[model samples]
Target: MTTIEVKCRFEAKLLRPAKPGNDKSWAFVVLPRDASEQLPRRGRTTVEGTLNGHPFQATLEPDGQLSHWLQVSRELLEAAGSVVGDIVTLELTPVKKEPEPDIPADFKEALAAAPEAHKVWNNTTTLARLDWIHWITSAKQLKTRAKRIDDACDMLASGKKKVCCFDPSGYYSKAFRAPEAENS
Candidate 1:
């Protein structure tokens, strides 16, 4: 029942933004390095928190070579009536439930169409499924995402239970580390 509360500014820096004439960009609120260490895990932790009085559940993810961050979707900002650079108050408690990835509709349909793959998917653990979903959704392009769905169905049907050569941890894959966490 350890509840971690923090009051901090909303960091609005764009994360891995697309180049000129590119797709949409991502943004997040950087968790203070000290506060990040208080969490149970690095990435994909379910958090119950309030931002500017708006309660929400957020997936705390690692920033590349930096501290953990809460993805500040436009919806969230609007709901909280917050904008970039606004100071925010957060009261967070890590929930015990396993996180479920936001599976794209196309991917779900693809799996449903492939019974064998769907069976495999159903039998996989939540974290394993999350990895597959992450790998697919991580694709920056529409075509690439579609390709991943096709590849995933084929691979799963062939009895592959996990994503090939995929690292679920942000460490080796993305080298995400906070200055304080670097030594931890």
Candidate 2:
């Protein structure tokens, strides 16, 4: 219900992006690379925009390939009277400020168990915390995720300010990527 200062406007075709376990994923639109360049950062950015006249506020995720993508919820699609495969108009702009990402419970617990890591986490900026969370959750497997959590705690305890060696834009290292579309 916030008034977004409209910036970049464009149209894109909706597609169903894949989820690891859930076959039925939300319709999503990948922002044009140029449009993404207009945003604040190549990392995770918060945006508010109208999709086919339906209002929405969401954290725009990096598309791994250097652009950005917004997951269109079914409710938003229905409200817009559109669906996957339809090209939709979008009046997009980055939010004035970034929101903190909610920490996963397990990660929160691990931080709590490590006083030094917890202290560092509390002292870090929201963006750094977000990157740490992203690096941990980007793991496609449960084992890798657990290992990342432990490593994160150790790194933080040792005074690391941010996640090192993580390619947030997925432009390099190829460790992160936007979910593949069903038809991709």
Relative to the true structure, how large is the alpha-carbon lDDT of every model? 0.68, 0.86
Worst 10 residues of 2 by lDDT: 17-26
Cα distance off (Å), candidate 2, residue 126: 0.6
> Candidate 2 on 127-171: residue-level lDDT in tens?
899999999988989999999999999999999989999988777
Q: What global local distance difference test value does model 2 have?
A: 0.86
Residue pairs that clash (backbone atoms under 3 angstroms), model 1? 65-176, 66-177
Q: Using lDDT as the measure, which candidate wins?
A: 2
Those runs of model 1 whose alpha carbons end farther than 4 Å from true positions after fitting are 1-27, 52-54, 73-83, 175-184
C-alpha lDDT of residue 71 in model 1:
68
